[model samples]
Target: MRYRHLAAASLLALPLVAFAQTAPAPAPAPAAPPAPADVPLIARTQATVPQPVLGPVDQALRVTPATNAKGGKIHMLPATLETTQWGWFDNAQPPVLTVKSGDSIALETMMHAHNQVVPGTTIEQIKKTRTDYPGRGPHSLTGPIFIDGAEPGDVLKVTLNKIVPRSYATNFNVPGMFGEFPKEFPDGQVKYFYLDLVKMETEFLPGVFIPVKPFPGTLGVARAEPGRYSSVPPGKYAGNLDINEFTEGASIYIPVFVKGALLWTGDSHAGQGNGEINLTAMESAFRELNVTVEVIKGQKLEWPRIETKTHWITIGYDRDLNIAYDLLQKETVKYLVETKKAPDEAAATKLMVTNWDCRISEVVNVVKGTYCMTAKTAGKPVAKLPTAETATAFVTVGTDADLNKAMDTASMAMINLLVEKKGLTRLDSYGLVSAAGDCRVGPPAGATKTVVCQTPKSLWRTKTASK
Candidate 1:
């Protein structure tokens, strides 16, 4: 099933999920400003209780001995200024913590804006922090946890074991920050909530409560490139995906780029919607989050893929929604072919249209995201997808800031593939690709925008002879 988006105006008017856990409703908050004409009356309030103070930066990165199923060592990572990256993913950033391939991490992740947003903290204070860190992302990512054996082209298997969050959260959107409805509400707003950890829910307004489904909003390995990259837009390395499906019981496979797969994760969220329209969710910190990392050698992945009990998710990112959708479709079809789930491109398309579910991952990020999900039982289950190089008729254009240039590069590559590999005349190759080639956008963020085009492998398969 797809995730739901929580609209800004009607916080509780939209549908919400029900959980078995229950608790007494919390008291109303102290009245602050009167609701705007468009905002709900119940939504205007401030926390009377003092927010829990988070940290004094831990001087030394430390780990204590703990047990796991694989008998792997556990590392306890605290969310101190010294431990977390302010707002960037840089391959050059040295690892603050190192672990074995199969070791588990019992870690703490901070809230948005580098754990600066808390009860009684004013919007002006947040603005000052923004000015303080001029070019960095707001997410307080906690690592560059170098796995001892990970290498380029390998896949890092991350399994979510547990996530328990702190007692409060903040949700906000800045006026000029390009949220879904920035123009409608000129004066941006910020709101807070008290999470009942025992019940796993949070109070949004007087009677409205949202379930506390916690997940790390940003998780990725170091990029192959050298420079520091903003953590706002997610790319091939899967940073700031903001996908809610990455909760407890879900596993994500990330393609490793740099040596040791320097993994970093943060941007903790108590809960979020499908699109994260207001540019934020119940942004909060985690008390204790557990994950197990393993390095799978020989296998490869062009983009990140997620797995849960019932579904397998494929992702795509691009500035254009349509191109993002196409990119998702391309990844799905490519996965189907390489995993032997579909006989060919035509069959894969049929399967997708008939059974898969597509949803928007997010819209607020600079590079928008779209993803598709197919039930685990749709076909023979694949433990992992093969490398993109295995495909005979596919070309992936690397990320570019310009969307047009990215597509053009992919188009040219496809033209050459048809001419050189399929033995078609150059003119015919161009026409054929223009008419039948499927183009999709892949990982995109900051200055990276990737486009991939794949023609049917059956195009080169020997046709049957007829009498």
Candidate 2:
């Protein structure tokens, strides 16, 4: 989210709601001055862009093996994980990582303020980085992973398997970049926070401790457009959504624009309210992101939607709140009709109104969003998950070296991960392809120290001739 202030017109005319599990207001601080803008952005020549290597699955990017808490093997993504290089939601940018649908990803994420705003960082350093850093938008995002067979009008179903905060987080207030009350705190201020991951709490102020619910602030796919778009707002393809419900165990469905559904994610927030209220939160670098992104062919979506194990949620986004509300209504109705084939519109409306509640997903972004949440209790059903299918390629999870060793013999088409083998074994299949693990034998998880192999297949068939 931007921390720069603009003319009064930028302020939300409506009373925005900063939804939270428990909101305890912090004491007031001085009005902060506006944060500085980055230098203007001009498209770079192809020479500046790093052309993808040899093929979709880079042999060189193979990662080493690592152990999960359970001592089973998991993957950490290839060192090629995007942190330094990032792009807008525009389809123009090439995907940094490529995987078939149902592949598991152990992604790493960075804080919004980025390296310049980290602890021990100085204003001078920030100003210096701004000179070279493209100023197209705010937040440091990683991704745009190309999903095989994904194309425009498809929906990417992302399941957040695990999210752990790497170390510290940050919260800042820059003059023009925060809330409408910019004059209240002149000049910007950034604060660092030490996390207690084991305890799963962080101190917001001296007396209050905020529960940590880590989620990427921005999660989106490249838009089909040729021109670059700013990541400062939420869109139909999804970005900077700041939806708090998207924590671990949640599933988000984002619209696909490109053939691979270049999904990008970053702006890690340890905890945040709906409106975000301020410009930042427990913004932090993240480690051990266990996510599975599946492509549901032909399931077109207009806006991004989310679902927790207990609730089915639909989203509506627009610059106009009224328009957002109308869209939300339609989305809810459509969901009901598709899932239940309710007798009539009135019955569907009654079911939604009587059984559901709404949350203002976010109001601070230039494009606001609202979500309709329906409970999934005893008999009530939730969104249908993608049925099991064969995996297109092997998604090897382990440390880089472990994966490399395994690939040496497995010699199958491999997408390596550097991970926490969370739930890697629970799924009988990896969508379309059978998965094996431990880097030595196959692709999923095991405690072995060598390359795991999958059963022999066609050209890409893998072997487990242990070394």
Candidate 3:
């Protein structure tokens, strides 16, 4: 019986006896739940704040309305006059106003004339005489917007955001009136070369396109005296500086005067040369300016300074270039010694000799001036320094072979720090890095096969030091 059972088992173990058979297979891990479709694609976008507006005046400044048959009507806001004058005074009281840092202001002018399209005339002269002297007529002008808190010793910082010219006309040069070259030049002899603005294009050259930028030629704060001041010359209070820098994205520092810094701004120019040689730029009707004002306490400046994204310019005005240059040099030397606090005179002198970069703002203007030299500091030139909450750190984790993964992870961390920890707008944070950041990866020191990441010392230090 045992032999028969063994024989049967052996027969069952044979390959032909069992043949082949299979069971069902399992399904794939669910397909990843499809990922959320609402995730943002872009990292950031530039943001802008709404600008503020100033309407017709009240008790602070006297407001008067004047009308014209040809041009239209305008609202005039005059400053408190200590004394009254019959003619155009060289020192006119600057408009008084108030503002804070980061606020954008716009000035609008409305005026009318019989010959809507003539040029080369003062607004007062055009209105009273009522004669089309070919090139001389009253062109409506406005502003030298005075910022509040600007005083005798401090600087008034103005950041121009935008300037627009809504209307304009041309003035043909005529004999006997102002701006006539040589007395012998006949009256109305100059052809009608002036442009009457239905709208004309500004061409810098044959192929280049120049956008129209309008600003007040006479922007300045009020004088310190109790009496009415003239508007002709630019003084410590800042009037009629004729600085071309009043354009957009520029920061202008004006000497402060009086309490609340009575800032009056008007007389917007569509465009003009440095000297205003012909006594006019693209004389037009009404200009709009978007500006921001800031007051620096206890900052006494002898003259105004201007800064832009690219340049740090100093304005020195005097009777002679030598005097202006001397003043500029003195200011530059003081700035270096005081602000930078170079170790000693030799160190300061070396800095000036080795790294100083300077240039002329405009040499031919009637306002004899020399814009002294200086190079913009080599780093992010922000309007204000970064705060701890806004700062960021960039760390290097590994060699080049692993750089891509490291950067990807590091960037995610940075985003998290900005959005979750710092409570800043994601767009602003990204923009800050974009405009003022740099990254590099290269072979590590003394390591032939390894690489390290690096960034500008200033930015990196600022992030680490919270300064």
Q: Which candidate is the best by TM-score?
A: 1
- Candidate No. with top lDDT: 1
- Model 2: worst 10 consecutive residues (lDDT sum): 426-435
Give the local distance difference test score of model 3: 0.41
TM-score of 1: 0.68
Per residue, candidate 3 scores C-alpha lDDT tens digits across 267-315 of 4455543333223344444445555667788776777777777766666
Off by over 4 Å in 2: 2-60, 63-87, 122-135, 378-467
Candidate 3 residue runs with Cα over 4 Å from true position = 1-102, 110-148, 169-211, 341-366, 378-467
**Superior by lDDT: candidate 1 or candidate 2:** 1
Q: How many residue-pair clashes does candidate 1 contain?
A: 4
Model 1 lDDT per residue over 162-233, tens place: 998888987765644445444543455566878888877665543335567888888889888777666777
**How do all the candidates rank in terms of TM-score, highest first?**
1, 2, 3
List TM-score per model, in order: 0.68, 0.64, 0.48
Q: In every candidate, how many clashes are there? A: 4, 57, 38
In Å, residue 224's CA in model 1 sits off its true spot by 0.9
List pairs with backbone clashes in candidate 1. 327-440, 327-441, 399-449, 400-449
Q: Which RMSD does model 1 reach against the true structure?
A: 17.6
**lDDT, candidate 3, residue 195?**
26
